[model samples]
Target: MAKLPEGILGPVSGTIGSIVGAKWRGVYYIRSKGKKRKKTRSKKQLASQAKFKFLQEFLKPFRPYFIVGFQNEALYCSEWNSAFSANYKAVTGQSPDFAIDYTLVKLSSGLQPGLRDPNVRYAARNKVEMTWTFQDEPMVTYDDQITMVIYCAEMNKAQGSIGGVSRADGKFVFKLNPRIAGKELDIFIYVSSLNRKLISPTHYLGKLIYASTTKP
Candidate 1:
């Protein structure tokens, strides 16, 4: 068979391990239940919890992305890295390319005015969107065209019910104009805060995004 894509391996292993472990744990608990043992949470439940805990721990390295008000929230991986590299180049007069990773989380909730009934379940659900941006020095090119590619490392969305919450997972790609001497170039990603009132003014979170450049 052809080789599987490298990205498929991690998710596949996680899924298979979770399924097999849950089944095995469940079987063990069922067998124990017949021995008149004290009632206890099933092995499956425990294993699931353990799995989640393990995943959470594994994901801890990315926690910086979730913290509110992190700088560079609007930048995606490429933009953030590129900007950083470009800034370094601008300041040092040497081009150095690097990469950064980031993640975004958004939550929204609200209450709506009731029309006919004074008290009713008529509150409009809130929505949220997160955006990232990268501002960098301009680039020079002999050709007239530039191309950018965006790849999403991972994305997850949880739909809300009464709150009308929804999540989106994907990467965005855009080609920027060559950097000009006086003009600044920027890349932006954003999540809309629909129906949700902000606790503070909507300033850039500045954390959940990163960027890198392909060229040295």
Candidate 2:
């Protein structure tokens, strides 16, 4: 039995043939009332699930950066989802083993000009310093905020800054966590507008061992 609250042409509620009609979260939906059969997942399906799960865990630490880095691409989806969808193929491996290729990872995307002659080095006292030259492109401003992301898989940690530096500054420095010391870390950097409407593609600063000897 189905009832059309708004009339015969409107949405119906209750069972209609093999489906049941209902409203949930203010949205009307129809679904089959028949019991669903249990089906074993294929190898490909299982592999895909593993790949997605792996990527999700790997990307979890970068959520803060993704909020602004992937904002432009988040018109329909969340910033995190936008980042995942954009880099899924580039970061994941093929077929059975979906190993992540960190070098191929991209953290942000936009037409904003990216860093030129970017460089990173370990300074005294466990501090990491990054420097770059800004490209002379239209709409590129000196106030564009700089964002850095660092990941150390061996220590299962990620750290970075989202803003506070600008393109005109050309350099930024931050101290590393002692826990991740002496570990090989992957570093990435990009620039985004103050309002976060624009962003530059992420630049991989390559892997570097944080062999800092100083304590504190």
Candidate 3:
């Protein structure tokens, strides 16, 4: 019997060299120990040979399993991308004329399935706004501005409903008839989780605004 490493003790030899040099069956035979030649084979040597053979058989099926797992992961990623794009379109109403901006924030704690349970939560938000001044005359109406804002909010709500219990907020502002005093109009649309607290503003994924208007 060969001395095993610390924390490992068994009738079987610990080192591969010990197992290969073991002699019980014809598989392995001891060379020579001290002056005496130990030729008898131990029962432990036969068990070791059986263990090695079992390991060879067990690993044969692992390759295909790993391949299938990779394929499933790829499919999942594709579906997630499609869903995200669709949601963005639905919320914005107008298809993005420019490149979409995206920010991802990871939750500190993992989330649970229930409504209120706080776990790992991730959020993505988008904003799109534009303002133009006509040198000739302003043709856009207050009703048009209100309608656009309402449409945007409705779309955002629909997106939030589909994407779990999340929050969506949007605002549209227009300076209608700036020639007239106190004629400006503004609209806001905001949504949030009913159960969990809203993500902190300091969080990396907190809030972002992107629009055709001047950035501040």
Identify the candidate with maximal TM-score.
2
Better of 1 and 3 by lDDT: 3
The sequence of per-residue lDDT tens digits that candidate 1 reaches over residues 1-216 is 222224644222212322321123123111122244577879777655554443343334323222221223323333233333322222211112222222222211112111111111111112122222222212211111111111222332111122122222221222222221112111112222232221111111232232232121
Regions more than 4 Å wrong, model 3: 1-40, 66-216
* TM per candidate: 0.20, 0.78, 0.14
Q: Which of candidates 1 and 2 reaches a greater lDDT?
A: 2
Off by over 4 Å in 1: 1-40, 69-214
**Rank by lDDT (best first):** 2, 3, 1
- What's the lDDT for residue 105 in model 2? 78
Number of the top lDDT candidate? 2
Whole-model lDDT for model 1 versus the true structure? Answer: 0.24
Model 1, residue 91: displacement in angstroms? 42
RMSD to true structure for each model, in Å: 22.9, 4.5, 24.8
TM-score of 2: 0.78
